[model samples]
Target: MNNDIDSALARFAGAEPHAGLAGLEDRVMCAIASRSSSSGLAMGASLSAAAFALVLGIVSNAVPLAEARAVSTLAPFGAPSPLAPSSLLLEPR
Candidate 1:
């Protein structure tokens, strides 16, 4: 095993240096820049979506407990949902 290792080392020492590929550095740099730009856009979109969700949650939760109870009491059977115009129309006496 020692002899094999020595022979391998000797072969490597005698080998010529490898010529790197042309424009490899430029291509790698361009790929990195494109990935970075795309990641930045993705990060911005993710943050925007998170903020929108948070604001929506806050706004939805800001309703008073009494108001929530009142709304629930008004539609206990889930009929005539809140958005139905018929629910808001008052019957004439």
Candidate 2:
């Protein structure tokens, strides 16, 4: 039994390691280079999208401010009472 185990161990120990995919190093380097180049494009697109959103947000909010104040002015204005039911509701009751 011990000899059988020893022979099996010897066979395993002498077995060659697997030969991996050919040109693996070149494939990995190419993938890294391609990713690095594409990253610049991705970054530029992200920045442009952010800038456009900022501009749109500013325009949308800015355009509404004056109109909101005008609409509010046309209604009677005074400080709302703490106990007012209308104030508690999202819209005027």
Candidate 3:
């Protein structure tokens, strides 16, 4: 068994690589370069999209709606109505 294993190992070590594996390194390098370039393009596109969304949000918030009215009350604007169920729970029973 040991002799058979030693012979098999020697045969494997002395074997020549297949012809189909020629220029494998060049092909692998080319594929890597192409993938890296595409990733850079994707990153740029995502950043530009985020910047556009941010600018749009800022512009939308800065401009007031035409149909909205300005109120002069001193109370907080978004406070819940006094008659609401949630507000009723806070009142003295």
- List where candidate 1 sits over 4 angstroms from the true fold: 20-23, 45-93
TM-score of 1: 0.33
Candidate that scores best on lDDT: 3
Residue ranges of candidate 2 with Cα displaced over 4 Å: 1-33, 65-93
How close is every model to the real structure, measured as TM-score?
0.33, 0.35, 0.40
- Pairs with steric clashes in candidate 3: none
* Candidate 2 lDDT score at position 12: 91
Can you write out model 3's per-residue Cα lDDT over 1-93, one digit (the tens) per residue? 579889999998999989989999999999999898879788999999999999999999899677676564434457666667777898998
Q: What is the lDDT of residue 12 in candidate 1?
A: 98
Cα-based lDDT at residue 18, candidate 3: 93
lDDT of 2 at 1: 56
lDDT of 1 by residue, 15-91 (tens): 88677776789999999998988797899899999999999899878864554335344464656676466756764
Off by over 4 Å in 3: 1-3, 41-93
* Candidate topping TM-score: 3
